[model samples]
Target: MNPTELLSLLALKKAPLVGDILAKKLIREFGSASAVFEQDKPSIAALEGMGDKKASFIENKTFLFKKAEKELEFIEKHRIKYRVYYNDDYSKRLQYCPDGPIIYFEKGKIELDNPYVLSIVGTRQITTNAAAFLEKFISEIAPLNPIIVSGYAYGVDILAHKLAIENKLQTVAVLAHGLNQTYPRNHEAYNEQMMENGGFISDFWHSDSFDRKNFLGRNRIIAGLSEATVVIESASKGGSLVTADLASDYNREVFAVPGRVNDKYSIGCNELIKQAKAHMLTKTEDIAYILGWEKKQDIAIQKQLFVELNDEEKQVFKYLKKADKELLDIIAMDLQMPVHKVASMLMGMELKGVVKPLPGKLFTLA
Candidate 1:
């Protein structure tokens, strides 16, 4: 987009009583952001949903344009990049969502062309087991070269972003604030490296400050930009669950990791599964299977199988490897290990993508 048109879009964003939905309506009616600005008051009011007050706001463009000019200066000085909703560079998945941002500012080289995009979200207070699962999950999916999207906050969100980087997969951080600064100040450490492969995206301008309510808007981008949203962990009420709901609203698949019934953080995910709102995700391959994503190449399953395992895990791994499928109790009794111990080992191996649990307590090598 040219400078004039970009400025007009910015001004349109700043206009009072005109949000993404209304702005989109105006853009469609006038053909372009610039054309919307050129229309007379009567022309603006004549359009559906436009009243005298909104028409006056569109007519009085000096204040909004001034603000847009300042934003333009910041964009130019910082070398920030932006994608207009109607442009080819915009996110294809997001384009289908009518309420997606009309324009969003970005910094760094974010490759949106990747066919497999998954948004990972969860509770801010992550558990050790959840962290381990994410590590193994990222490792398993790394072979698909999927683009990972997250809110860039602490816990599951940041963990997802960090793991994506570690695995050399492109990751996008959808921020609740503007590009001027990272929220939670301490996370600034990951900014440089994130921009190296993925980048930060935000609909807010440099002038916008961090706000609690901004998360609802941010979550939509997290949901709309991906083919699926994965919730590693979440409490009964939190932003991650909100993203899952939004993803469902967008008709995208939502998956949640199951946790023990009484676990506090697992309530949301378990509820999702019980309510039929999300698929019960146990392993990385479940994602590929449900989404019909063929493995692009071997995902190092053999390498993971050989990974250092405790004596008990080794015994169970050996037993499961030789058999097509075995009952959990049979393995425990045959190996002379406690049923609980075998169950625990199976869970660990499942996270490692070395074992998969089938119905009726059956276990098999993944």
Candidate 2:
């Protein structure tokens, strides 16, 4: 984008109470960010969701525009690349998000055309088991050549980035702060390697101070960039869970690796499964199956067909084969089996590689 247009966007970003949604609205209505700033107060306030209070902020050109100028100078000096929301290079999945940033800075060679992208996130206090699971999971998915997205923070986020590097798959780190400096300081070790394939991205300005609250904004980018978000491990509450929720809000698939009930980090994953917010992820194949990453011919139906199924399990399987998919309750009702019994039967069948569970309590033949 030209400096004039970029400066306008930076100014829009600086406006108080003028978030991404509102800024984009103004831009769409005015035809350009520069035009949005040209509108009179009466014109700006005339739009829905805008009023005197909001208009005042947008009209604060004396302060907001000056800041934008300084930020633009920094961008030029650092030679950073930014993706405008309407640009072709912007994240395709993220562009559809209503609250996606109008522009975000990126460092490194990031290719958005990759067919598969997944975000792995979790608590900073990652457990040994979670780390082991991530290693094996990344290895299994390496053949698919998927892009990995994550926060560059410690624990699962850093682990996900490093694992993607080790597997030779591109990895993108969504930062909570600007590219002016790396947070945590210690992670500078991986910066050179990350830039080779994936790289760092953020919407924060060079002058923006790092804060705890920034993660919420950063997490949205991670969630928005991928077709699916996986919660490797999280406590009952954390930024990872927030990312999972954002992914669900975007109508993207979410998967969580289950841990023992009492495991602190497992609490979030179990709750997501129990609440039906995420599909239960047990093995790497679960992701492939749910995402339909595998071609029909690759599924070895012969092996599954030969796997013996009990009478009730066979009944469910037959119905599922005829129908594309079915809900858990519907299967129970149609088969005249108790819901609990059907649930148990389905679990056993899933283990036998004859059934697969989907989000929203749905099931399908594996």
lDDT of 1 by residue, 131-161 (tens): 9999988867775678999998999999999
Q: All predictions: root-mean-square deviation over Cα?
A: 10.7, 13.5
Q: Can you tell me which runs of candidate 1 are displaced by over 4 Å? A: 295-366
Q: Candidate 2, residues 1-366: lDDT per residue as tens digits?
A: 667788999999879888999999999999999999888989998989989888887658878889999998998888899889999989899999999999999989899789889999998999999999999888667656689999999999999999998867899999988898788789999999999979999999988877899999999999999999999999999999999999999999999999999999999999999999999998888887898877532453533534666667767876786676999999899889999999999999888877889999999877
Model 2 TM:
0.80
| TM-scores for every predicted model | 0.80, 0.80
